[model samples]
Target: MIDLTKDGDLWTVTLNRPDKANALTEAMLEKLVDIAQDASAARCLVLTGAGRVFSAGADLDAARAGLATSDLWERLSSAIADLPCLTISALNGSLAGGAFGMALACDLRICARHARFFYPVMKLGFLPQPSDPQRLRDLIGPARTKMILMGGEKIDADTALAWGLVDRVVPQDQLRGTVDELSADTLSASPTHATAIKAMI
Candidate 1:
């Protein structure tokens, strides 16, 4: 589940399954896609998860049910990656498995100091489809991505920031404020200018 709140030109999307550490479900992915579509009119977007984690990744039950290949999840991932607004993933806690894809899809990532990053799909006997390999390489370069994916190691927030996987790392309490300030800064730009600059990148 997810909740969407709007404040002026900013949109905040919160993953709302704290009981399960916000493990992503197929329905949740569908709603995420819908929210991203609606965010087209906003100047900035912020994504965060409820409770202690940004997300633990895919719901194991759903994954076991073969829902990973659902069209909804694919569409949601693509939509988030292509969102026109400046999108930021507020990594307030650990991000694992498919959740890494969600954060990587964002234009920028702001993480809490205590956060950890991992992609355990291979350990789960599954490979990330939909071109996650290239996205990981683009975010952190091939060598680092290979180390993380192949080694199946969990990296702390500092290491992730150093590797360019996260744009900023701050205290847990500062996460939301940091995202708010960054979103304001992003929204200050002309939409055309922002779009053009992003296109060039």
Candidate 2:
């Protein structure tokens, strides 16, 4: 469900189950959390997906078999949020369901120009972890969060940028290069300043 790779200063964690829309299983979630928690030396931590969809969030089918979605989600999101270095959600494609929380927990989110950001919890008849809505609120605002979680508005890359949901958008072909540049720029700050600024922010 996930693949992790490290090259010098860059660490990337990718959701690999493209055929499954990158839906996260409990085990997958645990692994992701572990990766984030252990990423101290990396200058940049990137979360992305392998195929056309970034991640669908919790695996509903697994949940039917008793996967603890709320608990696992809380752990994973919290781990990402606490990463000391720059954390970027590199959305290669659409993001949906609980995956929105994953993206929001990152310090920055950059997406493909055509990618969509969807929240269908209300339509699916269940709310995500209690803290998820708040994370979304922190990124955008409570009002906009309500519009998505309650009012049922759909968001594309453009809309997400306008609402401050995503930090940048690039053509699909240029996404990797864009993220590479940004990662370099983020790491360009002096180590002390980077850590201090990150802490202060």
Candidate 3:
């Protein structure tokens, strides 16, 4: 399930199925894609999860049904990357599987202290979404990216922060506040100004 909350020019999209470790179904992934595509109108957009784990990636049943290799993952990540608004991935916990695409697409990423990061595609015998490797490489570099993708290393939050996989590692209780603080300037700036700045980068 997904929860979208809008406050003026800020849009927060949350994965709400904590019971499933926020694992995504095809319908849920489609909803996220639709939301990201529609989020261009906002000044800032935040992606996060409701529980301790951001996402365990696609739901087990869904993955077994061919969702693991679906092109929707690429479509969703592309939409997020193309958004004119400033985008942040406020990772509440561990990030894994197909969920990595959206997080890697974000302009900024901040994760909770307990969060772990991994994409076990190699171990699971699936290739990652098309854009994920380059996006991830852009953040943390090729060898390090391979350490996760090819070597199957599950990186902890501290290592993620140190390697540039995430921008900050904050306490779980402060995650939303941290996102709000980071978004303040973008939220207050004129849409044109913010968009232009993002474009210039």
Candidate 4:
């Protein structure tokens, strides 16, 4: 499930199905796409999850049903990347599989200390969403990207931060507050101003 919360100029989209480790279904992916498309009006948009795992990627049954290789993953991440706003992935816990696209697309990623990052597409016998490899490479470089995508390495939050995959590693208790603090300036800025600065970057 995807839950969207709008607060003034900030919009936060959360993965809400903790029971399944927030494993995504096609419908959930579609909702994320819709929300990202509509979030252009917000000055800041945050992507996060409801529980201990940010997402385990596609639901097992859904993956078996072809959701693992769907174009929707590309569409969703592309929409988020195209948004003319500051986008942050507030990773609550471990991030894996297809879910890597959204985090890779974000302007910044802040994760809890215990969070881990991995993408097992290579091991899973599916190519990653088209843009994911390049986005990930841009952040952490090709060799390190290969370490995860090819070597199937599960990186800890500190390693992710060191590699530039995540911008910050905060205590879980301070996660929301850190996001709020990071969002404050953009939230108060004129949308046009924020968009302009983002474009310049």
Best by lDDT: 3
Error of 2 at 90 (Å): 0.6
Winner by lDDT between candidate 3 and candidate 1: 3
Model 3 clash pairs?
A: none
The runs of at least 3 residues in candidate 2 whose Cα sits more than 4 Å from the true structure, single-residue gaps closed, are: none
Error of 1 at 171 (Å): 0.9
For candidate 3, report its TM-score: 0.99
How accurate locally, in lDDT, is each candidate?
A: 0.84, 0.83, 0.94, 0.93
For candidate 3, write residues 76-138 as lDDT tens digits: 999999999999999999999999999999999999999998899999999999899998898
RMSD of each: 1.5, 1.5, 0.6, 0.7
Model 2 whole-model lDDT (C-alpha atoms): 0.83
Candidate 2 — worst ten consecutive residues by lDDT sum?
63-72
TM-score of each: 0.94, 0.93, 0.99, 0.98
lDDT of 4 by residue, 135-188 (tens): 999998999999999999999999999999999999888889999999889888
Give candidate 3's whole-model lDDT.
0.94
